[model samples]
Target: MIHDLLLEREQRRTISKLGLDLMITPEGNIKVVEINGVNSGSSGVRELTGRDIDLEMITDLAQNGLPLFHLGKLKDQVFPHFVSELSHQQLLAQKWMHPRAPQKTARFVLPIVPESSDILEGIIWNADSDYYVFNERKYLLINPFAVEHAAGDKSRVHALFQGDLLAPLRPKMAFVVRANKECDVSDFKPNTTYLVLKPTDEMIGRNVIVVPTEDVFCPDGSLKEHPLAAYRRREEGWYQEPNVIMEELISSKKIGSSRTGKEHNGCMRYLILVESDKGEITIKHYGGYWRLAPSSIQDSNLQRQLVANYSNGAIPEHISDDDLAEVRKCVDTFVPVLYRRMLRLPINDRPDDLPLEAYCY
Candidate 1:
């Protein structure tokens, strides 16, 4: 499903890498919960498994005669530093360029700047001139516009890309409330037992509110107030400032650990690399790791059981070959459909707002 999304984006822009946060339901269904374009988990996978997946990614691109440029802010501290060290050890040439720095050849650009920031100080921007910047540097600039357009708006991407092949794999969205709009409590149907309220652009489980329609009970089974009682009543402080996406809560399958005799509700992080060379696209599955919920399946806290995210103190487990094979089968079945859809659409028929220069090759 993600490969098709990448292919669709490639028709207008160049995007080489993408990550999908998947949830396996009790019925053995794979749900694509989130799509990550920038800073996908090469580093986290390494940290969890002691495998240098990022280095493997670099080697793969290098062998394919493709040089990748890492765009990020140094102050962010994690990815930029890790990529710098990895590139240095690989003997790959590296250079740092500020947004206002004179255009120069560089394999890596530190401190990723805004898309509207000046690429060259005191010079009128020219695509022709900027083309040389990439060509001369012998590297592809991971376009910020492409990243934002493709992954920033979660609700938009889901709406635009649904098909017979994708519809089953995606979680059902309840509704979308535009930025700064008030969420009408009535919009949530009474029969809907569980729902997820989150910002459309946020990642790693931040600012997520999981609401259960009925009142939740304490561990002792005593009745407690519902989590969103305030929101339901439209309390004074309750306001949805950013675009809020309401999705039906899809419960994860319980993963049993034979060695420990315990079970967990888990989420998987699958990374995929899409390389475009001479108009032919190649996709490689980089394997994945499992994030187990902090508490076991027996825990009473539904929030912890539902959201298995690394940033939220979830435990990382090495994914088994069986699990990888299952996910691979789903990808194999869906990708061809996505590709055919792209092929049917003529390039001239693509959206007019897409930047012409974004077609990297």
Candidate 2:
């Protein structure tokens, strides 16, 4: 009831794959006071984000072929400015035996390397609380959404919100929308929260419009039309997480799902992204909890060959068509991009790694 269960599962799967926080159950049933989210408004929610370590230094190390451990260790220092503040109070309350406040993990947007024709379309709506970044100057685009004020009467809205009250809401995403803008929303229903991998540049205080889910997905396959439609589809078979289906899709030239018309069904809608290296191109597919990189072999033939190898085969007899369609989305999108910034800077480049920290406004 609180969030999109499918997207939530994908979200949990995503963060776990990236070595982030574990998912908690009853997320919807959880006390409003304890659930983490942003307040809705005409303007939108806005939060600051940055990293502690230097990107140039990290890039330099990478170029020099230095030990990867340093990079990993440096990763610990990277935290979202907004999340750090939220985490601080949560931890303090935990230490003092006080009621714990909801804490949001690091999230953000990264810049698309302009002019680089290689954009991964499957990852346009990626968002994760904890983000990982490997760039010196990176940012994330965020979308704004509303949650019923369940977190205890805004007792300390100031303490929790960290950003200016009249400030806009900004959640990291692959794209950004300005205030008063109307964007396409996915077939996703209203009040239904879906998780995405954080895309990299926030429009900085701007809320992006998303297309409606109904207009987004075809009619028959839409989850709203038939609740069972979105369930995992088994006929598509088990391709495992991060597998790609385009080779089969393009080859078969089929527009429908992986369901054999039996019990198994598949994703109701698909994620459509426009990427540009020399120019922008369109990519469409279901996405979540998976990073499907069609091995970037130099040879185009090899790339096609690699994709074929990764395509899903026939769904298992026991697998429900619904199940296959849902999980199969994992391989459809690009990995979520992370934008990390250190809040408390240290004089020495290396600050003893710190568990994500935060400060109240």
lDDT of each: 0.55, 0.21
lDDT of 2 by residue, 1-361 (tens): 3123222222211101111110111221101111122111101001011311132222332342222222112224442321222243453343311221224533333334555533222111112212222221111111111111211112212123224321111221112122223333343233322222111221111111222335323554333332212222224432332111000111111112222332211111112221112212223222211111122223243222222111232121122354335323322322121101111111112222432223121
Worst 10 residues of 2 by lDDT: 243-252
Tens digit of per-residue lDDT, candidate 1, span 1-361: 5345445544432334567788888888888887776456544577676776555655565443333334333223343213442332232233322222343533333344466543222111111211222321223434233333445567655654465667778766644555435444443343346767777777777767777645433444333543344245543453544566767787888876433467888888888765443345557888888878877878899777767788878777777787799998876676444333333232211243433222221
Provide the lDDT at 355 for model 2: 28
User: Can you tell me which runs of candidate 2 are displaced by over 4 Å?
Assistant: 1-228, 232-361
Q: How displaced is residue 198 in candidate 2, in Å?
A: 15
Best by lDDT: 1
